[model samples]
Target: MSFQKLILRLAWSVLIGGSLLAGSTQAQQLPAARDTSFTVRSAYLKEKKNRPSISIAQPALPPTVQASYNLTYCTLGARNLQLDIFYPKAKRKKGYPAVLFIHGGGWRSGDRSNHLPMAQQLAAKGYVTVTAEYRLSTEALYPAAVYDLKAAIRWLRANAKHYPIDTTKIAVWGFSAGGHLAALVGTTNGDKQLEGSDCNTSHSSSLQAIVDVDGTLAFLHPESSDYQVSERPTASKYWFGASQTEKPELWQQAAGLNHVTSQTPPIVFINSSIDRMHAGREDMIQKLDAYHIYHETHTFPDTPHTFPLFNPWFEPTLNYTADFLDKVFKAKRWAAKLGLSLLGDSEDYTCKS
Candidate 1:
């Protein structure tokens, strides 16, 4: 039972058995309900000796804080959806701005530990970072994963005092399928009632901004007139339900771009040129422009999807993310050197309000 195999199994199960929409209603879009018990577990994953171990030589002191453990916040079936939070432990009066990260495995397979290195690095650079696991595409469909992550945000807000997080300064960052969820969370802020059952506080789970890396924003491609369907039959069948022609409106509802509003938060979309999701990225940027939303787009000249995470530009990309978040938190127009360490790269970035 290696880690990869375990995650694959979980993914398979979720996509196969759990992704039944609320009901096969005749409506254009299936009405979604709050899924409170969205629990994820590491027991679904085993230690992989061959793969890279999630070990980072974090400095052992303040201003470089680190915390690693599973927090049982949401539950699904017998397993509790666990989240890993990492932050720079500072002696300052208030905690740092929190960044919630979601990993990408095509809404199917991925683990919280997969993003541990990024979490640790961000934490070391003085940001409260969290990587969480939500029910995958197998167990639930489009809105389920979306709802679970929103629940995680609500859980963080509810336990802000316990974690000493600054609720007002929260941003979401995700890749691939996780990127889709992140973008949805950013744009769909008006729909807050889906906070699920774990809410007992007034803190809102709405994100201040979003960072989407190679996620599908536009399900309906502009370049393709044929509407060549997705290869993942289960993904298409479960998300859109039946034929695209039979339910064009439902299919549109599943598309993230259709939901974008002027109220959408500031966004930073990054992607690789060769990725299949590139067209969707461009479409999202165009839509953002049409809505007058503040956004930044970065394309990794000649790389593939998720390459920015564990390879050559790892430090650079993470640094850019930290810097990007810094800008978003300063959206209120600050008047100080809200500078970033830039992963120790000798880059000087000092801005004022």
Candidate 2:
């Protein structure tokens, strides 16, 4: 093994005992260079020991949904980031609301394809759904992924006419690390510093709603598990390129909880039983409550961290997400028609549940 692989193996050993290598033979088969690339298959293998009968969700599109693959949204230096868009074939008179899905891999590993199944399901439910690729920690650290996601949002808006999307009703949905980015994007609308200087600058990167799946809102919160294994390099450390103590400002800047304001959009959080996975959630919700911003929280008891990719929790996950998006986006549409703002004490125009 390479020195890097050896170190990673040692870190895994320290984190989960020697069982890390013994748990899944498939994990050992992956290329050492790409071992950190988290995928649905790898997640299944990791969770199988806990839920022996757990099944993986397969990618299948409904007949009503048409998908376009590998559409390049932005080109950074020599790298071209691409996205997959799924939309209903039957066009809506007012255009469909758009949702951009970001996959979780602890900021280093997940791919856009991780959420393709969810994208197709939501597309079938009358929304333009997109799965986007962003810079991983291995490629670029910290705000690069954030910048790429915001750029993707801008691309969706710039191309709204072609895809039957309502430019005014775009939301971001993310899993784990991606969920962190999604929530951050929702809270930091019009943030010049987080917004990159490439691709679709003419369009705004603001989001109407946010769906965070098992993502932490604050990295330094007491409830966070980020630095629990002090000896090993945590994913946040890798992505931030520094320890929390070494660079507290960067950590706070990336935290969704630190950015929440009254202008922040409606948000829904779907969580697993793991408390550390959704750390800083309750505190952020407290802020939302103080502002009276619409938000919902749902927890799946006794489920694996990656519950949305598995069978039993997959359908419910989809239901909660779709229901939340429908309520929030529909309310926005209603408010637009009545020329009333949904922000502030407009509780009557805001969505519940």
Candidate 3:
């Protein structure tokens, strides 16, 4: 094994013995060369001999995740919003369930590449994952990012046949700023006002599931300002164009919690127990309850705001995510066939589509 691989393996072995890490998690083992993977290995990769892979399922290792980057999904004015698509090369009888990932940089700044590892990990688990770029505070403000996301979803659905994604099985996943957008997209289904007339306008922007990691749900709430930052243009200020005091209505509109209704999709919240990082979450949970929406929350106790971006925490974070998606997707299939609502309410989302 390569020296790096040896160190990682040993480190994992010790970590596993501590029972703090998921024992089933394994990375690709570098071959003294390469085999089993159908694609040609680069000289550098082939020399490693063993590539490390990890799996939460029965597979010995992660499936080969193929990444296609910088595919333009939509263009608003001069800005060309793009996405990086990641999926396993393993063919299936039908299309794979897909998830659109949004990155977190307080919404002021963040590139989609930050979530490439996440896209690959999700793709390895038999899902088509797309990490997309939307307008930032540097480019536009408020709903522009949300509109871009909705456009991307529409674009994905319009090209679903070519990409082989199950149009009926789409979800949105995001972290922090992306989390808020994902939640907004999930809750605002059928709202034409937010669904900008971008590419693939005919396709629906509705989502079947949402994964929010430490995202804000409402700017109107007092708890929303829990995080104090020194960035010249704070995320909220830049995104909203002014303080909530100056434009309360616009701030409320930008917040996802203000839009949650019975039509919202099933949502799973992965967060740090720090509470404020997921400001307005409990309030939204209460709203979801009142609306009879299906939702779940997984809080990582005593962790930093960057829990989802790093290891130890990342494994369990993803494990919960994969498991939640699997459960929701399976139930969604049955809910559609039965013509029943997955949220245990009268709203038949599957049938609506």
Candidate 4:
């Protein structure tokens, strides 16, 4: 066996051996412990130190946007999955488009609160925005997070009447690990296998668009950082419950790139200079092109992986995200009115450092 495969084999053996000794029943009784090491403040501090002038964006509810926090969207046994919604207090005749923001923490850490500023800002722009919390790798495994995110989408649709949301115009935007989930949720719309059995099954979980902020599209792709096997167990390993070698199929199933089809919605990629953060993006874009799907890519040079949480890059990220959503949703509204099938234009732009 190859060195990488050997290491993965050993890692799996150690993980399984430890779990067995701990007792399966004992493990199931309690929710897995969350990795709380990663947070917006920690990320901001790290990035701020790297660049002295950079500032962390504070979360604030603008006067025009009203927010409802800790609203339960789903309940798994004893665990209550919650989300925060920020929407314009002013009503609109046709209803406002919606965007669900997912925060990234390698699937093991980070909270929905990380994206509060983004959600608040987007709500001020006349879109109903949500920041949702999901089961992390510590609490659940691979498909659990996916299932929870889909439920959040369905929850939004189910409560559209209450929130004045234009159910037809909804998008998912996520950062890092959350970005991976967002893309997976966007591509796997209507996919029965990934769609969990519970939580507002009557309402569709389909998304009109996806914004993946530096999230990898494919976990198993050659260009992916996830493919690089290590002696120590990685975050993906924890989430998958095994090494890539032990569960290649699970890794591939979780990859958004594997699920892309003609019916997949338009996607915009906002990436930092880190190439590893966007592994499998180019290949996914190729698939998007084959299907004539609309997509855009914006790369910010010399920025941290968590650039969206800080200033300098933060405003640009917000603008790009809002502009892209408006373009896609507006085109959809026009198409619906005119009865014309239209796909928005695609572009690739790089922000100079």
Candidate 5:
């Protein structure tokens, strides 16, 4: 067995005991490096061993933007969390804004790679984009993923020189399950668990803007009663660490809606009417209004949750996100408003080819 695999096995045995924690809760074993006639050696090492490292030089002359893949950073457990970075490649350039993306799979089964196409699309538009990977459900739960996300933000700020990231202007975009995570990260300002270790040297997980794509926002709402899963209680249980009825307080604590405040980041929360899972988006937006936080809510006709990425609403949604970012980052007086008026008349956001 490889030494790292041995150590990992021992460590996990101690943490997980005999049985798996729950659904999709299996840890991926590191491959053993050496094997005998009856033993199996590493199956994946050939690719890593053969690939040559191409070091991308920081462009001496300023370019409007640049993109790179597979930038890695450490998470709370020292797991090598990887992210893809997109930014302006030129020196003397205005530190372009940064956007971190989290994917959706009920907090259990998504990857940073799923956001690759989206990251590349954004990177092409002069914004620094990072598609990040956080530990999944089978291995960890609840706050573990949040911790990794916060660590990613901190790592980006600390290593601003490594990429052309704007520390002062940061945004988070998440889809479905990821939308809930993005909202939670943006809403939770001083959460100690989400804070990075002493090595981190940047501001907190407070984002300048939040883009929620078909995610649940409230823990106590009747909306989530629709997701009936047998193996797991509900999607909320997988995400917030408790069944809503079993532990209301814990659910509320993790619910992004519960964390809203005047200081909450400007948010663009979107969902499709055909997706029953997001029945709560309107209610959540109402709550955002109560808190006097600036936000925009959109619903696409006949489209299901998260389908905006490829369906008819895809281009419109992307354009809305880009426009929303510009308004939130540049507008000062309107930042204090919580009404739909902050969107500057609904006609401005009307879908157009």
Candidate 6:
């Protein structure tokens, strides 16, 4: 292994004076954990790949980074839930702030690999980025994808040490269908109904921040924009398994806007100016303002639905996202959770009073 890969390996090893192996990394979040403990899943680290040098801010460095692909984060009913992880070799003992990238396909068809270019670009900029695959509506339904991503979050935290990651600074970025999932994961932080079974339950699925690009926020609309939703079964039927009238509760529950609270993480909405995708956005922004949580929005006038994920618009999308995340990662709430690098040796120092 190269030095970068070696540093990553050292980072993953059991931290000295910490808990034993095999336990979940829940202790990273909970204070007085009677059962929760730091953990290490060696299986996830067994495979790693080094890619060619990719230039970003400056000229190319010889050894750039490595990507660990198809690493199992969870397994449910004959399918293995996996994710591709990319981390730069720019050694940071404090690890890198991670963003779990979810793809978009109306909650039915989309592969995690679609975000590979985005992940590589983001990773080159100094953040650990993960592109994850979740159980779709076909394989599951309603909150199964939610639970899958949540489980992925827990699994990521569980294996934080193995990769250069800051457990507290985790964020989520999604486009379209993935955007809804991202919003769901970000807002439904503590709700147990959406949280699924047996995937690293110890750690939090809640995000420190989110980037929702043209996702469906509120299904309930009052004809404010060009888009329209039918009262009968429609696009959402694939995921919800019923029409809005048949399962009003499920529709309401699945709307990311309904779950937003004062505690919802800072978010940026990169939307197409003509799109009505953010149906309940104004109301949710009011809730966000009521709580004084940081938020912003950037709309591309006359752009298509996938503008944020494509060229031209994608440039601004990347800038806005990176900037927002850079700021969010440094916020007091997230910074306070920094283990060592962000805090430095001073965290180990105490006054000799």
Which pairs of residues collide in model 6?
Answer: 12-161
lDDT of 4 by residue, 93-181 (tens): 77899999999999889999998999999999989999998877666677878888999999999999899899888899999998899
Between candidates 3 and 5, the lDDT winner: 3
Q: What is the lDDT of residue 319 in candidate 4?
A: 96
For residues 1-353, write the lDDT of model 2, one tens digit per residue. Answer: 67887897577445343223322334322222333558899889999998998899875799999989999999765567899999999978878999999999888787888899999999999899999988766556677788889999999999987889998889999999989899998899999999988999999999989999999899888999864536457778777766677788999899999998878888999999999988899899899978777788999989888999999888899999999888777765555644435555432233333
lDDT of 1 by residue, 50-152 (tens): 2243222222334467586888767654546778887766644666778888987656566666667777777777777889887664455556666678778
Question: Order of candidates by lDDT, top first?
Answer: 4, 2, 3, 6, 5, 1
Per-candidate local distance difference test: 0.63, 0.83, 0.71, 0.84, 0.63, 0.68
TM-score of each: 0.73, 0.86, 0.75, 0.88, 0.72, 0.74
Which segments of model 2 are wrong by more than 4 Å?
1-36, 227-229, 332-353
Of the two candidates 2 and 5, the one with more favorable lDDT, higher being better, is 2
**Candidate 5 weakest ten by summed lDDT:** 31-40
| Most lDDT-accurate candidate | 4
Which candidate comes out best when scored by TM-score?
4
- Candidate 2, residue 199: CA error in Å? 0.2
Give lDDT for model 6.
0.68
Candidate 6 matches the true fold with a TM-score of 0.74
TM-score of 1: 0.73
Full candidate order by TM-score, most accurate first: 4, 2, 3, 6, 1, 5
